[model samples]
Target: MADTRPALPPLRDVIARHGLAASKALGQNFLLDEQLLDRIAAIPGPLRDAPAFEVGPGPGGLTRAILRAGAKLVAVERDRRCLPALAELEEAFPGQLRVISGDAMATDAHAEAGDGAHIIANLPYNVGTPLLVGWLSAQWAPLPWWSSLTLMFQMEVAERIVAKAGSDHYGRLAVLSQWRSDAKIAMKVHRSAFTPRPR
Candidate 1:
């Protein structure tokens, strides 16, 4: 079926209109390229009619991609400045996107996304490892609430998560990620891709 909803404005335009400069304190780096966002959203495989969760959806770039991929997305965003931009997305993809304005660290993601949901995000840099650790630790019980996770991290952190047992980067993160599930480096995004290049 053809999508008849009104088109959303470009992400850059939304950011400019809203005065949403990436906050270093929040570790935000917006991804403006829709095609790249689509590829990231697809890393976890088919999202059609499935539930998906996103953390820190600045200006709703990845959120748009996930909606386009046919997922019912529940996004937790800490920055209030981005809510209006995301609201635009909510209107464009009605009934497909839900925005929660609060710290992702404090949010009950599992409850919000429901069971068997896919967790995908271009995670905020500072909290990325902490969030992943929390999710990885959840495996101590039965199966995790999420069916899969396809998250973006700095190159160093990415290596640590998927490093082999004998590799130099191998340690706690690798153990946590590999203990219960098959974890792999799904993709590597270049530094320049971010709105403000991460140092």
Candidate 2:
């Protein structure tokens, strides 16, 4: 099997070097656990030649994992502070990682990563719901541009994704997320897992 490891600075070191503090304004929380990131990356299977998209890849913890998993990636990060850190990953992976400097909320992920891209991200806390909703609102079934979306959302949002149609929590969000794929709680990520541990 090919090696699946990235040569880059440790997440904490990267954050420290960049003077990065999780910003409540941006809903940013740096997921520092490598094991958890690997699990998230595994959900999409071997990406092989398929392009992958990530939003708000703060400091590139999961970004590294995705590339190691053999994905050709286009990662959109709103914070310019992280560009240098992500740049290191781009260097490590050579041609594999393309870093786009922009807000994921306004960017069209499909257009950036192309059709049939697997969308995987830790997702910033503030925009996760709205971004997922926008992706779900696409005018087609099965989201022709997206292969699958493995993302992290707040507990309440995760509950709503898999909520049954008749349940009080069920609504448009449920319909939209589940219609294209079998949405499920892949894992539970606690606040303690974040670098700043979002409240």
Per lDDT, the best of the predicted structures is: 1
RMSD of 2: 1.7
- Output the TM-score of candidate 1: 0.96
Which lDDT tens digits does candidate 1 get at residues 147-181? Answer: 99999999999898889989999999999899857
In model 2, the runs with Cα more than 4 Å from the true position are 1-6, 141-143
Error of 1 at 69 (Å): 0.5
Each model's lDDT comes to 0.91, 0.87
* RMSD values, in order shown: 1.4, 1.7
Each candidate's number of clashing pairs is 0, 1
TM-score of each: 0.96, 0.94
lDDT of 1 at 97: 92
Give the top-scoring candidate (TM-score): 1
What is the alpha-carbon lDDT for the whole of candidate 1? Answer: 0.91
Clashing pairs in 1: none
